[model samples]
Target: MFNKGNKGLFALVLTLFMLTNFVSNAQEGESIFNSKCATCHAPHKDMTGPKLFEVRQKWEEGGAMEGSLHQWVKNWQVAAATDPYAKEVSDWAPSAMTLFADLTDEQIEAVFDYVDEQPKGGAVADAAGAAGGGVASNIATEENDFGWIWYILGAVFLVIIFSVGGVKRQLQELDEDADKQVKVGSKVWVFKNRKYVGIGVLVLVMAGVVWLFLGLYQIGVVSSYQPSQPIAFPHDIHAGINGIDCKYCHNSADKSKSAGIPTTNVCMNCHKQIQGAGDQVEKIKNIYASAGFSPEGGGKYSGETEPIIWNKVHNLPDHVYFNHSQHVEIGGIDCKQCHGDMTKQNELPRVVPVEELNMVEGNIQLTRPTLTMGWCIECHNVKEVSTGTLEGKGGYYDEIHKRLLENDESLYEEYLEDGKVTVNELGGWECAKCHY
Candidate 1:
């Protein structure tokens, strides 16, 4: 019923509408792909699963039945039974593909459209593997790398001394009356300046003693000592991005002597679905092996387990009776107070340097190296004890608070003159408190 010009206009509007819809679908598909499919499958790279790029076309070219690809996405096992091409894909890898039963046919098609649009060479691969290792394995190497700088300076100093001595010798040889002057051998010169030499020797011996003492003081100082673990756990990703609480993994921090390493069962809670992509594929596979889990047949426990031997990061002397529960639960100290801001930590867990710990916001500034006796003593000297509202709680601090208030009024008044009670005033400085 419409004119030829009107019909042409209608066709133009329809084409524009379809193009806009396609663009919208592709954008939605990108979001879905990142949140769900990114854990296992990549657009162009084969990770735990095969590459998704051009997969729809490949299925079609291989004579796949209509709507079978969408069915394969929804439930691959059902698709493999009905379609010959889908069955071939089932045998593509030892690990089975994760089923997306929640996705609609349109969403499944949109995912394919998104995958096909991705550039084949590397962009897709790069984008897919975005959440890679937060910290490098060799990050600790730079912390103790100042020896080379000292070596370079020493070499420069030797060069300057030699150059000056050579210049002086040249000037002496140029003198016409050089032979007329009395020549003194090195031994004769030393004998003439014996007093100065004795002073210099004393100074050198004193300096050597000081240097030796400083070196011995640093014998137990383990700042920035990060050990290689079975799996490179990314604290930035889990704690920073995901906002997982510290207590969730180190469950015994408030109850035991040590903040225990999390078991594989705890890892399986989330990783059962997140199989991982690119470089993370192998790391996640190690977790799977430890947990006795198989991604095949929509993920299951095969009961064939392997232990992940994780190297301990922190260590203390046998004589030190440090209790994790006493400090964490009673003191109410934040993990960051000692551990630094772990949320932004990119590398493997290491003994955080005192300088780095001091830099963290709200942390008490201390000069002593981390994990040293001096560091603990410094913390106790300044750390305020909470005595409020614990009168009837029968807690250790409550009893101490009662004694301060009731036992000695003059001593309590003197202690309060500094504004608050410190751990040192409440027997924290007692040798037996930390020793026995």
Candidate 2:
């Protein structure tokens, strides 16, 4: 403390500590928000809950009682009873705020800090969209470069062979007894090595045949196939940042064979309040047109409307029979199992590759192409009939288990040999299961 150097080092250490602490708090806040608050609140946007940006400052400016904000988070009713400002907050929304009694004051402050620090409208979306675009571009570039890479390698191999042959010829010419030795013609050399040449040709032919068949098999497999849509839907904004559930839009996934596309009325439910800005204005205008909503003169719906024709993304052939309800409600498969993470998807929905699907956490690793018979077979072979235990949840599988247990104990025991019951054990792989 006495020396200048010592003071400088102390200052530096203090600065570093502050910075580290700030980062740790921010990260912790984000984790907690994602786990608990993200479903309702967004930083700069009003979702189910009001926007949290500057909310702490706002409460202070609004003459809220000291420590009332923290108390409100823990139990709004207690805060509202004691503070007039908290009572006003309670009246702001029809839906009640969920109580977070377990959260400490420090945790609530951290969440507010994180929210207040966030960049306003579209910044997060822009960054996420840029990252997603970069990944897609890189994947496309790699696929395009693949054929040229093999060609370049083949050319390099040819050069090496030619260079080795040149050295051998030079050495032979430098030999004193080279004139006495006879050199064979190319045809003569090939004739002498006909057995090896024949074997090589046979191997090449077999390889070509295999390659051709593989190419033929891949004819209809369209992984990463993104078709242009009428409306450019930003799934990142809705699903990722805003935390809209997949089931909210695709509401029929648990009831019907298809996960039904959301109607224009559903879009209007949110867009009626949020008219939007910038490029989003044009997109929202399309929704308005489809829903017959006019934002002008206090936002009324006109009788005239046009239908929005959405292009189907995941299409299976007619011969293949799949039930969305059975998989979603009964089997309890997560949407991300086949669809990958739609939250990060900025572009229109595409046929996600099996490799990408495997990369997603909790997905069963698959070797076959996406949307193929082999892929389905592989999933059915591994995917358990029930998650963890089959005790409480009652469904077709439970009934099947009961029958097997009562009628055929040996068969049930045989099914349990692997310590879990899979879909394949219950006729998932039977010819009639998938086939019409």
* TM-score of model number 1: 0.57
Off by over 4 Å in 2: 1-184, 387-394
Per-residue lDDT tens digits of candidate 1, residues 1-436? 6433234334434543443354356445654554346557776677777888898888899999999989987778899999998888888875555556768888777777766766665444554544331111012112222343355335434543443344344334435444575646643454456467456544543554354335434433567866556578889888999899998999999999899999998888889998888888898999999988999999888899977767566655434678888888888788998998999987888889999999999988898989888999999999876654574332888778777778887888787787877889899999999874
Per-residue lDDT for 238-346 in model 2, tens only? 9999999999999999999999999998998899999888999999999999988899988998889877856566765444789999898887889999999888889
Q: Give lDDT: candidate 1, residue 132.
A: 34
RMSD of 1: 24.7
Collision count of model 2 = 0
Q: Where in model 1 is the C-alpha error above 4 Å?
A: 1-192, 391-394
- RMSD of every candidate to native, in Å, equals 24.7, 23.6
**Cα-based TM-score, every candidate:** 0.57, 0.57
Residue 74 C-alpha lDDT in model 1: 76
The candidate maximizing lDDT is: 2
